[model samples]
Target: MTDETDVLEELASLPTLAHPTASPDGERIALYYDITGRNQLHVLDVESGSLTRWSDGEVPRAVKESPHWSADGERVYFHKDDDGDEQHDLHSITADGETEAVVTLDGQTTLFDVGDDGDTLAIGSTAAGQQNLYVHRRSTGETERITDHERAAHSGVLPPACDRVAYASNERDDSGNQDTYFVGVDGTDQRRLDVGEPGAETVPVDWGPDGRRLLLSDTSTGLNRCGVYDTTHDEVRWLGDGDSQERPVAFTPDGDRVLAVRTRAAADASVVYDLETGERRELGVPEGVSPFVRFGNPVLDDRRVLVLHTTPTRRLELLCYDLETDEYETLIEAEYGDLDPDRFRDAEFFTVESDGVAETPARAIDLSPATELDIECLLYDSGERPSPLIVNPHGGPPVQEKRSFDLYTQFLLTRGYSVLQMNYRGSAGRGRAFREELYGDWGGAEQADVARTAEHVIETRDWIDEDRIGVYGGSYGGYSAYWQLVQYPDLYDAGIAFVGVSDLADMYENTMPHFKTGLMERYLGTPDENPERYDARSPVTHAENLDAPLLIVHGVNDRRVPVSQARIMRDRLTELGYQPGEDGDFEYHELGAEGHGSSDIDQKKRTFRLLGEFLDRRLGRPVAASGRGDKQ
Candidate 1:
């Protein structure tokens, strides 16, 4: 039997490295490492395998974003936010640890691309009510706004010349459809590329090694397709069949091939596409292992690339891959102190069929039972028979559950709890139609698919305890927890929602402007435009129907979903005679210094403990009282 405390501590204490970028000469790498349990900028000498901390605790900010190397590779550019406020400010630090702020704009400012000349930076800021493009010159300390739009616009790669930029914008009449556009640095000659289908999203990926052709990633046809737009020819040459979701990682050093990852059912296969002969070569990665691509650059030396390798039973490890040899060496090994990797459970991927039929108070998505929708799920079953199950819906309608290590899931398994992660109808990684299916039917078909699939698992698998099932999630998943409890109250014994949306209409009003136009409006339109749908879908609207125990956790400084979501749920439950505190079933926790989620290690430990304690109390399976006194 596993010691619950030992499992939770080691898993929670697991160190993490993220946002890695290779230096220009490929001798060093810059990334954020949580070695001290607080994420900070660190530089790793590739040859010596020595790590050096660059950023001091001068400002005491969270460095959660990616770091980029300047053209000359003298300094690394990164973004930091106050606590978890999510208002990112750009900063640069030299190898010698000389740090300085590059640009501090209002609202959330993202450093998109550092130009080839190393002086100009392409950025997107929400300061203007919505996300817009900006060009900042590092030498002069001057900033120029390139585009003023009501919707969100994000920049792609900045070419060597830094004269023109490519970006994706949803400013079209149909806000759901996004297209790639090119504009000069002076904000002139702004023209749409006419690259994708009518409603598909075409986003710029990278410039070819020569900077003459732009690599474009298209999701307009459900599966991802690639296109090379030649500036001189003024034409796009499309690549790949519309089979699987293929994403362009980078161009080969010689510009003869494109490194792309084809994703099918959440599994990725890295392949190189020959531009001249249309030949495809697989990278021959081990089965069930996926390469983690950094936001911008993943390439290291001329033929080497950096990838974060992860498997279901393994934690994420940074690795350097040689394309020519198809071999990789672990740069930073994932450490799980005092824990055995063999104790970790592997995920069992399966699918459940649910008809696209749904019934809602305001709307019905489909009535035909003939149209069955497939919902994919990943289950990590505990060895114990009749295991208490936690149905965990992933956070995004756009983010699906991947075959990767999850400490929380592992912790739960050690406590004899089976975890079920679902990709209900409208989740990403399955293609565009699978994603868009949840649009306009937020709590409708998507919710149905999740509940039905959970039910299917409970019925088919005798190992899952139907009576002790719980629903848990963060963000959209958090919203699903509330919706599931209220909609199918008898199905769940308890539910936990983290930074989740409670009232759809209120979320639309209170969230960031970019979320309103780019995310919410794209799904349910404006609350004013579809008030009935919004009212019907919002969980707070159905708070009276909540019958099971609920634990609501939200970051007070959350800008994406807003803390008001948790407040609204708590207020409604209070009004419905559900008192909160240690004495009540409806519990609420407001993280003071956090935004969407927490970056503090102690806070994470506290959260896990709280969650475990709640599950123990609600499920009537309290931890065995060891010498540690009732196993806190």
Candidate 2:
């Protein structure tokens, strides 16, 4: 206990690594790390323990993100935006750490896809609020705007043999309708490949390692179906669809089969799909695993794939799955840094009475009014005789709470607080219909499920106190916290909303163009068609119902749910006589040099410590004094 660091300290000191890209030769792995308080590109000698910084300290404040290695292993490409400005430009750093601009256009240009030969780069060229695909060549130092799509256009992969790039665009109709398109590498032969149905999204996954096919995942049939686009016939063939969502992990080197991840209910399974007979063979997942595929990446050799596996008894570990013998080997250590894996608890996935899945280390309780549908709820043990409980509502309506490591949940769990995560209606991995439950009724059905989840946790858990229950979430989850606290005040003790939406109407009108059109317009319909519906679901309309302590934190540069929402929320709270600060029920913070969420470690540490302090004081429970395990 004396040797263990607090949750805030751990979260602050630990480095977050992402976007791991390997060189074409598979000798080096380029990863973006936030170890220096900001994201920086670092190259790892995969065979050795040597780590080298790929970029010099020229762009200190610029978040060095999206590190992709050149096929020749000579250069690394990345994008950087200064001072949180959206004016991103593409830059390439050589093997010797010398960086130079690659594509400097009028508007922001981001490197989307780089070809195998390392000469051609697919760039998302944005100007005057519209983005289009551009092909940039290093050999000729020439750039060509390919699609000329008036709407947003994003590309994925370019086959080594074919002179065409796979992309998705909504050029004609911008009702958030996105479908796959292929255009020539030199701005010719533009053609639409798939006529996906409305509300269907077809995204280009990646180019085949053998250059024989292009992998794609289509949601036209309502479930993400993994398929391949044959370069020989230029025809698309589907492997599987419906029921569980199938995501293509990687294609075999010979192009004879593909590794696909199938999510069935709350659990995940790895399968190998045959390209010839279309036969699928289910592979063995890790032993004692709760069956959530945390990490899976195909090694360049196609002999073994790296996967992150978690079990109810252990934390996550990178395992190498060999395709030939079907054996697994530990690739990375089970422990992170010097942190002990035994001290952590893995979430247990459960099916509620209404078929909803809830995940937590806590005991799950079923809550359903006599007339209402039952909802799943997790109850974590606080270890104390009586303890404070925090209800966690996840973002993404269709994102399920699975058996995996949740950093925030772990942080709160170690602080002697029980956290409840709800897998409400519309959460994915179940099926098409189950995930589509909140299509036009986002605030209606999901809110009921969240309320039921919280109520069940407090009413059934013996250690949880009803008056100390709180809700916290970010983005979509942020909306859940704000909406739940405002509409059903008596049900929650306090609320902390991070980059959340307070008013659906305001969100629909003020969000960024693509998000406003893509997500909100499709999720809740346009305000022009459903003004009353938007108002009915808005938490601001029922401001009089808010009586709990509320804290709102938002990044000022957030374009998804603008900072204005937080300002408006604070205005409403002040108008309702809730003062700001230590004694008040309302508090707000707007962080600069940040986006919706951030990769800045200092800011994250500051925000997390503030959260702990607020919860400890509000719930009347100081977490620093608690060291006992709260596993249920």
Candidate 3:
């Protein structure tokens, strides 16, 4: 008999499998796993519970993803960087364990779709400076460019008919707007589908079974809306208009109905929608315990819809919900048992008064133990009162914080701490106007919103130790943490920035070749037009205002926000008479083999452990290294 401790240890050591793709016949599934620091593709027999690895034993240099099954289900195609240039090439491997390269390109290539005939493959390549769609004939080894554009083309789809390909391109409008278009296999009959407004971005999500209609998820109104466009008539019609987002997952095999995923007003649960009767249903393993129920572009057979569902206590398994019987059957289950479900939360939106007259609808997650609240405070207390509070500003000043299962938040909560995830004015999901609010004012108004959110938590929540408050974030979030040290010197007791950009000028000059063009214009303003904005927002210029103890973590291979950003900030802080690892000062850690974010499990674990220790040291709490592990 196995011991209880041994069982628990075995469960903890279980590995996770991700990116599941079903074969054309829906009898087999292919997935990737990082069992021991190497990614390997595995194929599982649906009926036999037998598995086989396709990648032999040697790990690919870069990550392997986007597994696409061929028409016959005998071969699987994927993209990986065999060389060190960061460009991915298309490769195909058969179920019998034979591997071969399908096509090679000069620049990065993403596998879009394999044609229904298995003779043609659609791919996106950046061979001509900008990303465009291409059709490569496996027989001739000749490539044909489909879309010619300056911006980029994304979300490419090829119908089962195999005559034409549909994709979204930002060609017509130069304002970073995208629209759906289609082209023939021979590069003839290139025409843009009328997807309503030009300012709105439309992506072709899926093709109907008959290949006569296309389902599109449009973001024209700043919210996701579904529309069906008839290819023959070139007309579009919306399914519904609500302040929510809708995604078309799959079309019924008969092409009579569409399966869609819908998010409610506050963006909590993802529900399913029926196109024919306008009926909505929530799919899950019952409802009480927050089962992780997600639709993965629904796998439709002739008889049923195969929906993927799981939870924190359930492994990724497929359930076949019959159309007639409405009964469900488990089709496939991961070899591992009991997985963590991706947490989903509703956005609590409220207007916060800023600059006296300006009121912005600020969104945030409470994470407070007490729900009964009549006052507005940044800190709160429960039975275990007076715990340390960490104000976490999300990266992508343009990206808003959403309610999802986050490992970081769970880890902090387990260590007797409360985390406040704030979605400032510049965050996405609210609308275009809110997202553009940070265009020219990076550290000015946006920074003010961050301060206001923290203040709100402190004043209304009485259980928080206000003096022990800490700030932490990465990327743009990291910039916000550093700005907090300068804009409001006494706001946080300590600040921890991970792979953050401290100098705007250095970020503009040092980012990857592809990101430099937009980074210079979006956050730091144009180098020629607004040099003052660049100088003003640079955190290095205001480094002297940093009085709190600080810790900086960066990955040497980080191309988004390069390592130099952290090195420059550390040097300046040292110049200001601060010593490394000294008490009440600053510390730096440069992860050797990591990128913008630490992907290595050991590195992530160590980083979080160090972060918790630093926070405990500053907040006067007990420092314990043991806690909940990685979420993924």
Give the number of the best model, judged by TM-score.
Answer: 1
Q: Cα lDDT of all candidates, in order? A: 0.80, 0.68, 0.64
Task: For model 1, name the residue pairs that clash.
Answer: 200-220
TM-score of 1: 0.95
Ranking by TM-score: 1, 2, 3
TM-score of each candidate?
0.95, 0.86, 0.80
Q: Give a tens-digit lDDT track for model 2, residues 283-392.
A: 67654422322221245456665555665435555455677898876544443556665656555444345322222111112222322333444444546556778888
Candidate 1, 1-632: lDDT as tens digits: 35676666677777777778888778889887777777678889988999999877632344456788898989988877876778888888887778889889999988889898878899989877788999999889998898877889885568778998889997677767888888898899998887788788888888887879999888876787888899888888888767668888778667887878877766766777889998777775566556646475777766887777677898888887787888888899988778888989999998888875433221212233424777888988887665778999888768878888887888888777789988887787787877888777788778877777788888889977777889999999999998888877778888999999999988998898888898899899998899999998888887887877899999888889999999999999999898787658688999888888765666677789889888877765622322221211
Kindly report the root-mean-square deviation of model 1 from the true structure over all alpha carbons: 2.9
lDDT of 3 by residue, 1-632 (tens): 43322333333344545566667776777766655544677776766757778776433433434578887888888775633234667888886678888778876687777777888888888777667889988778888888776656767788988898998875652343567888887778888877757766688877887788898878777766778888788887677655565666666667766666554322333344566776666554332212122212345365466555543234445555666665777755544434333321222334455441112221221111211112111221212356567878889765545444344554555455667776666676555555555666667666666776777777776877676788889989999888777667767788889888788878877775345543456545555677777777778877887878888998787767888999999999989888778464888888766666743344546666677667666655622322322111
